[model samples]
Target chain A: MELFESGACDLAIKIKTGTISSEEVTKAVLQKIEQREYDINAYITTTPELALKRAKSIDIQRIQGKDIGLLGGIPMAIKDSIITAGIRTTAGSHILENFIPPYNAHVIDKLLDAGAVIVGKTNTDEFTMGSTCETSYFKPARNPHNTGRVTGGSSGGSAAALAAHECIAALGSDTGGSIRQPASFCGITGIKPTYGRVSRYGLIAYASSLDQIGPMTKSVKDSALVLSVIAGYDNRDSTCLNEPVPDYLTEIDSGISGIKIGLPKEYFEEGLDSEVCDITMKAVEIMKSEGAEFIDISLPHTEYAIPTYYLLATAEASANLERYDGVRYGYRAENPENLYDMYCKSRSEGFGIEVKRRIMLGTYCLSAGYYDAYYRKAQKVRRLIKEDFDKAFKTVDAILTPVSPTPAFPLGSKINDPLQMYLADIYTISLNLAGLPGISVPAGKTSDNLPVGVQFMGRVLDENLLFRLAYALERNVGTSLTYEGAVV
Target chain B: MSVTRKDVDNVAALARLSFTDKEKEELIGTLNNILGYFDKLSELNTENVEPLTHILPVQNVMRDDEIKPSLDQETALKNAPKHARGHFVIPKVIE
Candidate 1:
């Protein structure tokens, strides 16, 4: 009867066999949401009526001997940034508080086609900018593991929903560690596929070059199952690759034999927490024992990632968000004296402090006097960062490092200091800069009981290699801490 | 390395967000501290390095010149704050 704890594939089989009716499963998950929704603050909008309607349709199909889809009767959640037709899609900002999208994102369309029931829209940071979900107009999502700590942002709500058993799996966008970090914080698995691997037509853009839509689930196989359905080229997004999508679930149990993982010295440097470092090294040793070779690698530009990412992301954000002026759609001032007043009042009132800060920094970097000095120079550094990853990949199949320097901090810990919050994304940002694929798996737990995640970064379109290594580590780790009463 | 109030005002204007004088003063301090950390990048000699815009090797991905159906006017204008005659309406600019 507890459908939230089962894997998506298993749930589909149960539905097919009539072991559990789709209506019963939906009610169980809705009951779980009713119990824990306030504690985690995961869902911004819950759609029980729509979910029941969809479940009844699936039951009808089964009774008539029609073919049901792979994800038939499975309940799922989507990050608020992804548009859902006829649903209120607020990107955790006041700007579009009342805005209801008229169309679904490309991935949403795919999930519906697969017969997956979308239960709700999860919370996120405003425009997917902050590292902590605290920036949302809604209440900050709490870490289901530790109530006082944070669920990582801007996909924190999606991750928290999975961790708390509110949903089996969810969709999240990783612009710069949005999906991976939150998954790490909430003790779950998440993947950011290679750039152009998935369609981004319906995803709200934060940084066009860096944003990717991927899966956040309770296990590696579940993440891959969702990826198999969503990863493909679409004509709607010109940047989407026209290559063949891999059968990720087919290789979930593939052993990691003769696999080589790179351990970059730069990632284990001074700033990383001792507890995080110890757990990561243990994870590396576990992989080594599983017939995986360890090689010492150098990515000298690792330290430069923080600055390069902030500069480039903000610059793009300034340009992309320009479409939200008062004239067209989105929020507007109640009363405006003039044209300029309307523009200023609307933007100033709608955007949060962090969003405004990034926009200003972006505008400055792209200005007439500073463009060549700041923006252009940062772009050059971004090239060297990519080269570092390219050069390292030649010696190793994938690179392993801590997803974050530390476990999830307290809710309001880094909200005041923007730079400190940005620093939390140090390890995950460079992968975005290089457009590589990265996956985060449960590495180990800190001494104080917080979950630590180890990230595997792979070469372009080499997501299979990363998944193989992650599955090996997850099996070898040998400890599955239950969410109930695990927090100290 | 210290940012000035003038710098904050200029950046705000470029970003098209109006800030009160107190907010401007606060931002000046914050921006200066943040920009000060970026000085580390100047130490590295990146003269010959080319600026990398995208990670994947592919470039210039273009769609075919085929016309497609667009969103209807009603659906497009549904979220607009003010609209008239299938177009977004704004305050009059010219006298």
Candidate 2:
């Protein structure tokens, strides 16, 4: 495979063995970014100088015979939503357009410690409120395969980075299919670890309860490699689970024989694009051939995931976002009559359309008159959504579903129709609501050659199962996805 | 379940945001459409279920009371849009 097509693991090995200098790899990736960035719009910011400096240091360390961590000298990109010290971390919003974080997020610390050189921060939906990169103030990230189509988001830029070969791998946050949907659209491997499995310290919160940091890579093994580095407990985040991190690199290729996978009837039913459904069905057949058993199952509350996710996520987001007052961090209004006016004007000027819509929905729901009817009721329904997974797990070890309802869609096709845009994530939202680990593995493609992905969801903290399954599914079907960026 | 223009203004005020008349009109339509989805949640009977605030079973994640170093005033004010004397500056609250 070409250097751009090589997986992060292979690149790291080559770097470690002195076969190829990390500087060489970083330079090649940077050149690719320069070549294709105008068409793809994947990165919100590029750090070519810093990446080369770090890569050169790693090369020196190797020459000195010093130990380098597993991701030694690998070039990676992070979602702009994750904070990095001294880097302008805009969560694809104008509000913090000039905000350079003073502290690195926990994941940034981990990625750096693992010897991964961050190339840049990638685009996201403003405050991660939308499913496509269209909401970004930096502009929408286009799917590399087709310039007219969107890379699924709010992790669109991370997926785009991998698809366009702008970087070897990337990190993204998934709250309601932010990571997986874009991975599906871009035909890359992405996983949303079980909620709290990875620390959220320094990760800009959209909805604290549902967000997770995971890897977006060109191959499944690299996802495992990256996950192994970033997962584990940290006292900085209370919600981070206190558990021993598993060695995913060693566990990824576990055989699939006798593994019972659930094919949720709700997922396969009407509303799924026929091409996506066919691809997912083929994925199940591949698993069956590998001796995995498929059990027909029903997650009765599947249809309610969208409503529950939006309500709970927005409610939390409304509260979480209140910290962006004009008095403190981020953009401030030019003039204010008083403190209250300052707050109003700053927020009004800062947020984008989708963000404002979500905040309004959240405020309306949490209002005294409507709290129970909207926010609290959604919480209860959320419990039932989790309960659906609890019941399904009794019959099956993991669940298989389409990562997205369709492949990448033309940009602006559903931007005006918020409801239509929301429905696009129907297949992937339920996993977040249930707080389960789900990995998107590329499968077949549409007639027009748009890539589709299949999602394998496992019980909370059962990310091991997800990695193993995704690895096998990827081996069976992940080949032939060599399309690069389109020239605009 | 339906959102009106009056509802939009009330929610926007609570959210500490404002909108132009055109934006407000658009918001009213968008709010009603999204709420129509939330209305579906009311169809299910959740009368006796416990509200799940957080997914994991964690509470009161406390640590030792030993005093620890913290972000200095300078770092705290690093991203402040308006700051003076090592503190964030805001519009006057008094008349």
Q: Native-vs-model 2 lDDT?
A: 0.89
Clashing pairs in 1: none
What local distance difference test score does each model get? 0.86, 0.89
What are the per-residue Cα lDDT tens digits for candidate 1 across A1-488? 24667767778889988888777777777888899988899988899999989988987888788766777788899999999999889899888788798888999999988878888999899999998899998789999888799999899999898888888779999998999999888888899999999999999999999999999988887788888889998988878888898888678678887888899999998889999999899998898888889999999998888888888899999999898787767899988887877888899999988889889989888888888778888999999999898899889999999999899999898999988888889899999999999999888787667888899999999888777888788787632234323321
Each candidate's chain B TM-score?
A: 0.91, 0.86
Pick out the ten consecutive residues of candidate 1 chain A with the lowest summed lDDT.
A479-488
Best of the candidates, lDDT: 2
What RMSD does model 2 have? 1.6
Q: Write the per-residue lDDT of candidate 2 for residues A428-485, one digit (tens) a residue.
A: 8888888889999888778887888899999879988888888788777754234332
Q: How close is candidate 2 to the true structure, as a TM-score?
A: 0.98
